[model samples]
Structures are given as structure tokens and as C-alpha cells.
Target: MVDDLALARHLADLADAITASRFRSRDLAVDRKPDRTPVTDADLAVEDAVRAALAEHRPGDEIAGEERGGQVGAGRTWVLDPIDGTKNFLRGVPAWATLLALVEDGSPVVGMISAPALGRRWEAASGRGAQAGPPGSPEPISVSGVGELADAYVSTTHLGTWVEHHSRESYLRLVDACWENRAFGDFWQHCLVAEGAIDLAAEPIVNPWDVAAVQVIVQEAGGTFTDLSGERTFQGGSALSSNTRLHDGALALLRR
Candidate 1:
């Protein structure tokens, strides 16, 4: 098992160097057609760097990334999202991150989420707990203690999509019940849950790369992760993550 957290940190470092350097560079211009070249370049570069490092260190492991598809090696596969919030990156918003996770068979055991622009990184391995903060400045964080649904805070990313999918009424009902709400899209909201800064995150639509790393971080931080229907797997295309106390309540609201 490539269980070393240091290696995870190193991989995150490789991703950060590539992303931070080009984050808001005027030369890295954005076009109206959603020129994906810049973020695509960053993605491939970061993934390639990670693959190279893994080749040298964890030679027997497989690797998968958003930019280049999947490469099956050993039973263990490293899942990566070179930039989870590509739209945010294109918009000069610092909400993007590099997400890495080690999945054995079909489950993620270790996850690392690095957002250099936000000056934060979160890392977790099965049974090791989750850690987050600026590089080299780690803090032990966990989910919030608010067990009641009415006192909870909620974050919903991609509001328009929820309404488009006819889940708007239920979502609005959820908002009315929450103490506060944030449309802060992308991985940051999930990290907020991991840091005990937020109660629940209702993500109506996302891909594996979007939630893989966050899944491990939240679970390791003592929170629950599941589809809106409450299944543990991420295959349902949406997820509801929160402290265990309010998960069912949040799930009930989302399902309605």
C-alpha cells in the first residue's frame, strides 16, 4: 500500500506549483468560447507530474485523472482531478484545487485536496484522520457539533442546475430551514464541512473527480457522505455530506 502521507503531500506540491504559477496570469487568457486549453494544459501537466512521481515511487499502482482518462496498473488506483473547479479557474476565482485519492478496488482510502490560491490543503488516509491548513501549518479539523437541522448551515453549489432539474422547491425549502446559505461553488464548500465551518453541502450534480477527494476528507473528519438518497457510493451523480447528526434531516429535505 502506498500509504505514506508525505508522498501525498509531495504530489499535492507538484500540483500546486503548476496551478499557482498560471492561476491568474494575464498571458493565460480566457476566451468567450470557454477556452479550455489553459486549464487543460494545467490538468495534463499536473497529472503527468503525478504519474511520473508515482512511477518512481509506487511503481505497481494504477492511475486515473480527469485530463487523460484512466491507466490501470495494480489493484490500487490513484484518482486525480488536476483542477476540480475549472470554471472558477477560468473566471480568475481561486476556488479550484488539485484532488488526489487512492482507491483500492472501488473505494478511496486516502485523499488529498490542495487549493494553493486559497492557501489551504486537506489530507486524509483511512483511519489516520484528516488534516488541513496552509502547507506545513496543519490543524486538526472535524465536522460541526450542531446536531439539529434548524440550527444548521447549508451550502448549495450550482443553484441554477437544482432549479432546472425541478429540485428547486425542495432546495428552497432547505434554505428556509437553514441558519444561513452560501452559493460558494466547488470543492471549497466540502472542505468547509470537513473543517467544521459548515454543516451540510447539497451538491445536486457533480462527477467523480469533483467529489472523490472531498469524500475521503469528510469521512475522515467524522462526517457522512452519500447520495441525496443516502447511499454511500458516489455513483448517484449527487451527494449530501454533513455531520452524522444532521445527515438524515438534510437527506430528507433534499429528497423532498
Candidate 2:
């Protein structure tokens, strides 16, 4: 039987093949979901392909995906966000990626994120730690040691999301407290926190599939992952990833 992290990596590879091919294609099919979010043929294609593989390899496991949805119930569930930055893909930007996480009994134990266009991927298991970069020679990765917000670099998915889901003023407070900040939207920003490139990443709103993998990678990198309210669960509908030392300070500034 394939190991859980290995299966997650295989799913990422399967997703990368589909996303990389259709990424900037002029004929890619794009549709709007009920929430007015864009969904591409690539998104559906990747999730369906992944579900098929999970069915064959881990049939008893539950599956939850952005496109074809299921619940992350008791026991093991494979969580997927086929294309985490669909808007970027639509705009021909190379920041898009496929995110996969293995949530066992509601907690993420393994994560695999593949951004083939960026020529990078990140993976982490509960006890294995985090690694990212080239396909074959990836090295260990961890969060920065920056302890103070004044010396830290921060990132967020979108400024508009803060206004809609949380307090924009709260986010601005964090940006103002940090040394530098960027709108490094989506999965990439959180991965940046995991790699020590950035100290914190905050998102005002997110779904389970959006952050299950992020939660795993960030924690494995020796950072902290939590909702804005400071609870460490991916289901919080919001997220904050930070180097361990700076999390509480970042959270204090983002309090509603």
C-alpha cells in the first residue's frame, strides 16, 4: 500500500499534469460557481482525476474537494483544492497551484502543494517536517526566527477579503506593524511562511480545502497555523500562518 504522504504527492503530480497543460490556454473553459467564483475545466478535471485515484488506492477514505464536495468527517479524508489560484490562472499568471491534504479525523497529517509553473512544490508529513523547491532534490524548509513584528515580513491573500470576511482595519494593523507586506494571495503566501521567506500570512476567509494543506505544511515547518481568532483549526473559515514566535503578536494586531 502506498504511504499517505506518498499518495498525497502522487495526487499532486496528477494535478500538476492537468493544471500545467491548461494554465494559459486560450480555450480553457471557465464558469462561475453559485458564489460567483470562477471555476475552470482544469479545476474539475484535476479534482475528478484525484478522486478517482483515491477511490482506487484508498477507497475507504472520504474525499472533500473544492469542486466536487464532501465532508471531512471522522477518520481519514483526502482534501483537495484543484486550483487554488484560479483567478491567477485565468489571468495567465504563474502563481496558481494544486493543493492536497490528508486530514485524518479532522486534523491534517500530510500536505502536498504543486505549483508546476513556478517550478516548485512543497510537502510535509506530521513527523517528517517540510520540504520545498525542485522536484527531485528538495531540501528541508522551516519558518524564520524573526520574533518581532517590526522586523517581520507579512502577506495576505487579498485586501478586499478582509473587508468582506473580517475587519480591514484589523489587517491593516498587522501590515502597519510588520516591516514589509505584500498581497501574496492564495496558497503561495502561506507556503512562503513555511519556507521562512515570509514571517506571516493572513487570510480573512477560506474554505476547508483552501487551508487543510496549508495548516499541515506551516506547522511541520515549525511555524504556527491558526484562524484569526487564534484557534488552530483549518475549519475556522479564516487563517493565519506565522513563524512560531511572532504568531501571538500578529494575532493581537489582527484582533477584531
Q: Would you list the clashing residue pairs of candidate 2?
A: none
Q: What clash count does candidate 1 reach?
A: 0
Q: How accurate is candidate 1 locally (lDDT)?
A: 0.83
Predictions in order: lDDT: 0.83, 0.93
TM-score of 2: 0.98
Model 2 lDDT-worst window of ten: 130-139
* Cα RMSDs, all models: 2.6, 0.8
Which parts of model 2 have CA positions greater than 4 angstroms off? none
Native-to-model Cα distance after best TM-score fit, residue 119 in candidate 1, in Å: 1.0
Off by over 4 Å in 1: 29-38, 71-74
Candidate 1 TM-score, true structure as reference? 0.91
- Per-candidate total of colliding backbone pairs: 0, 0
